[model samples]
Target: MANAGQKNRLVAVHLDESIGRGPPDIEHERAVAIFDLIDENSFAPVGKEEGPYKLNLAIAERRLIFDIRKEDDTEVMTHILSLSPFRKIVKDYFVICESYYDAIKSGSPRRIEAIDMGRRGVHDEGSRLLQERLQGKIEVDFDTARRLFTLVCVLHWRG
Candidate 1:
């Protein structure tokens, strides 16, 4: 049973195909992130009370786009953010992800755990940055930001 707060969340989410989806692992991460995001999340664009919203996330002209809408597809607002602020963090995240994946295949449990911790640290940093950037535009909790950050990385993937 959902409460009033849960009713203010996203019911659907879409990622632009123009950005191109990543490889298998990346795709898996995107899927899991979206699933978790929809299952439980707190998302509300500032000053907007109508929701159970829909979101279409995309990257265009090197900018990040958040297209928010109502259940009937009525336009709410679209917030576009510069990709510049996320560049370094996103790059660092990818590097750490690659190392973590490789460690899973060849490294011991201790090494794998260590890399996973670093990966989570980088992920948290990106999430915090996202919340800061979206401040005054959208309000999302830490968990929601974390999941959205995963989707951002998915859209940012070039290969």
Candidate 2:
């Protein structure tokens, strides 16, 4: 559920291009995260602009771009963030996600659980970092940040 200040929530989200048709699991995760993100979220952009924002995310010129718009397709804001800050976290997240997938396939229950815990921790860190970076650009709750971070990782998948 969105809080009072969450009025600028994203009504739609699109990836500018496919991330190279990765593994099934990665595709699945991307699909689910995008669904969950749009289903309910808090995405208020700063300043006088109010939203039910539409977002198109992409990676270009070695930067992460946030193309935000209004419900009627009017451009509201376009924020470009540097990917340098996220490189390590995205890399770590990818590695842990692979480990988690493998653990699910053959690792012991204890090992799977432990790996899951680490995965969640890394995920939280990524989310926190995303929020910090987006500060003064957009306002998003922790849950929204987590979902958005997943989308960011998806964009990072290609290059």
Best by TM-score: 1
Work out how many backbone clashes candidate 1 has.
Answer: 0
Give me the runs in candidate 2 sitting further than 4 Å from their true place.
Answer: 1-6
TM-score of each: 0.96, 0.93
Candidate 1 residues lying further than 4 Å off, grouped into runs, are: 1-5
**lDDT scores for all predictions?**
0.92, 0.88
Query: Model 1 over residues 1-159: C-alpha lDDT tens digits?
Result: 133357678888999998676888899999999988888888989998669899999999889999999989999999999989999999999999999989988999999999999999999999999999999999999999999999999999999
lDDT of 1: 0.92
Worst 10 residues of 1 by lDDT: 1-10
